[model samples]
Target chain A: MKVRVGEIDLHVQRLSPDAERAPVVVLVHGMLYDSLASYYFTLGPAFAAAGLDVIMYDLRGHGRSSRPTTGYRLEEHIDDLVGLLDALEIDEPVHLVGNSYGGSIAFGLAAAQPERVASVVAIEAEPPVEAWSQRLGDGLARAKPWLITDEAIDLIKQAKGDHEARLSRGAGKLLQTTTIAEDVLLSRTIDPGLADIRCPVLALYGDESVLMEQVDYLKANLIGCRVVVLPEQGHSVLIERTAETSSLVLDWVREQSLVEAE
Target chain B: MSVDVQTTEAGVLEDLTGMLRVLLEEYGLEDAEITMATKFHEDLELESIDLVTLSGLLREHYGDRINFATFIADKELDEIIALTVGELVIFVVEALR
Candidate 1:
């Protein structure tokens, strides 16, 4: 469904169990080539089947969502989430499950509006800390030249496949045509305010992933944060380790709900 | 095969083909040939995201009778990647039963 959330219309999908008043869990996908489909095919149905009201939406400029040429800042993404919750009239605090860049937005929302988030499960993600901003900026800067070139895209098509090449092409377009790269770099860093997010957080990372570097930082900063490292896994934990990731997420949400009930 | 089974399979295939055509319109491949042998990822060159949209169309048409998620849940990633139009048509037909 195309939902009017503030200025843009976001493509949102909801999968709920037969029961009413189930805890809401919003699944936020990664950036660029990623969309709500990542969760739709993996976690969305699983969570819904487990009795959680699962909500998945395409971020602006991704998937079926409205693609404005601007407004891709971190806070703007947070604002989108806030507006979406209001538009949906969901008053209760909802759990947040974010992957990659989506996790940064989830953390930003939790810090910005602590009352709205019940718990957060971040998979291969970090909050928009100074380090994160710097890393993302450098990464995007390095990728820009390679991504924007037709030669590179064609090479990718030959080396990878049509599907991968298509994804790269979309990502290249997003980077070239929008202010996303610059806007994301200008995102307000929540480094100092990390302690303000009082809600429980479950940070999942592949043991071999470079993202594990942020796990200690998260544990040291957030009051109720728990870290889990999946051995023999890499950055693509959600896709590569779907069953394990699913079980871990379900267990974490279940635990959080049990804590809430007490 | 029985006449009834053939008709039902053909009906499901036609419905899926229509959905695929609509989905392919964005890529200017609306007129692309769609058959039971067509592989979603390979022949259609559909990203995983396209499957999400297809699932939505399936829901709108079949309602609660066909659960696309459960149908694919048991399959491995490779199986899903190599999925054929015929497999989905069969699932939808059996589900509608």
Candidate 2:
């Protein structure tokens, strides 16, 4: 189902959508190539099985959510999440499980509206810092040559390559027609004052991941923060170590829920 | 839960196939082929995200009766990467039963 959030309808898939008082676990996916699928393919069902109401949505301009010509700002993403929670009538704090860029958005919401966030489990996180924003801008600028190039599109937009074709086209249009890069460049980087976030923040990093510093930055700045590093993993720990990722996230959420109950 | 003998395996296969076809087409994979033995990654060339789209389709049609995520929970990441369409067919058939 969809929850209309300002400019577009956000596609939401809820496990136990009708559970009025169940502990809510909201999932946020990374940008462009990533979507709710990362969580759905992994921890979503497990969260539901553990009796935590699981909520997953495609970020705007990704997955099945509306692909607007603009509005991909960091603040816009935060608004989308808050608006979605309000639309669902979830007044209480909800556990936020975020992967990569999603972690940044989760932090955006937590910093902007800490009351709505119960706890955060950020994996291979690229914190919303000026450095990461520059990285995103540089990465997208670098990827433009291959991602939406005419030859590349022709090669992937074939009968046997529909999956790649769909993703490419969506991403191509997004980059070609929108101001996402500009938005990212202009949006406020996560501030040092976020140390006031009252929720427990669990930061996990792959030992081989480039975002280790980002995780460390959060640890340095945020309160109630804990860090876990997987020895043999990398940025894609979500997929590289799927079971461990989901189990750890579930365990964290479970423990946090019990803490809240007390 | 006791299996209902009335729901034939072939009948479930048909149901699942139709649902999968709709999803593939919706995702613009209209010409992409599918069979009972089709491996999700190899045959359909599905990315992790594609399985997510398929999972939603299955949920809409089968509801709580077929929990695709739980069906996947038992397998490790590599095992899930190597799963075949027939495995899902059998799981759905048994679950519906």
Candidate 3:
């Protein structure tokens, strides 16, 4: 289904019983993509079957939502998410899951509005802005230079193709500084400002992933973050290592339940 | 006799940077604009996050070819600035050899 958050329309996929007592899970996708037909095709149903109410939405300018040249800022995305929760009338804080860029947005929301979040499952995303930006810059320099192009929108639209094309699309988006709402969600200055965010955070990455080497640093720094590296996978752990990803998330939710029982 | 001195002093440095650039490009940073003087921080604008991410990418593609920790620590920005792409290539070739 689709919902209008503010000026723009958002594509939303909500799962679970209409019953109020059901646990809630919200899945947020990263930049230039939406939820319904994106990552949700795999990750969302798995979470829903794990006995939680699941919510997934396409960010503005993505999926079935209205596309504008601007307003793709992280704050705008967060506000849209808040608006969705409010409209749905979900009075309780919900479990949040985010992947890649979506992970950054999820962390931003949790840090800014701690009242709306219970726990977070961040996949292949880094903390705050400073580190992420520098990493982004480096990744751009190393991966593929030809990806930086003037026509980023067209490139992103063509992203769902084969490997080389997908890589180009992903690179095109990453290199375009203007299209990316740099400071809003994944800026260098935006600290996950909520000091009281003692909520459990599960940080997962692929074992062979270059980012895995630094997961230790993130775990050491973040207050209540735990790190797990999926063996033999790269950046797209959700797709490349789907079964393991599902099991890890399921085990985490179950573990949280046990902790609550105590 | 004096070959080792010339090779290590200038030849090795150039070769290393070239290889590093290729590695960086493979990870998606082809426009890195790297120079010998490009400090991972001040000059080239690389941070721990970049290094970490690059190391992760490297582990996947060039695992047998390089040692991330040692290579990362060894190449300071200024040390890298004087080298060219071709020289950098030779350095890596020697290292691999």
Q: What is the C-alpha lDDT of each candidate?
A: 0.87, 0.78, 0.61
Q: Candidate 3, residue A165: CA error in Å? A: 1.1
Best prediction by TM-score: 1
For model 3, what is the alpha-carbon lDDT of residue A164? 36
Correct interface contacts retained, every candidate: 0.48, 0.57, 0.00
Interface RMSD of 3: 16.9
What's the lDDT for candidate 1? Answer: 0.87
List of chain B TM-scores, one per candidate: 0.89, 0.78, 0.40
**Candidate 3 residue-wise lDDT, A49-148, digit = tens:** 6677888777776545666656655677778889999888886877778888788778778777888887788888765566666666555444334565
Best by lDDT: 1
By DockQ, the best candidate is: 1
* Candidate 2 ranges beyond 4 A from true positions: A17-20, A150-173, B1-6, B27-32, B45-47, B59-63, B76-82
Individual DockQ of the candidates? 0.55, 0.43, 0.01
lDDT preference between candidates 1 and 3, better one:
1
Q: A17-90 in candidate 1: lDDT tens per residue?
A: 89998999999999886998788888888899999999999999999999999999899999999999899999
Worst 10 residues of 1 chain A by lDDT: A189-198
Could you give candidate 2's per-residue lDDT for residues B1-97 as a string of tens digits?
3342225677766766776677677758767766778887767666666677677777667776877888887666556757888888888778876
Report the lDDT of model 1 for residue A28.
93
Q: What TM-score quantifies how close candidate 1 is to the native fold? A: 0.94
Off by over 4 Å in 1: B1-7
Chain B TM for prediction 1: 0.89
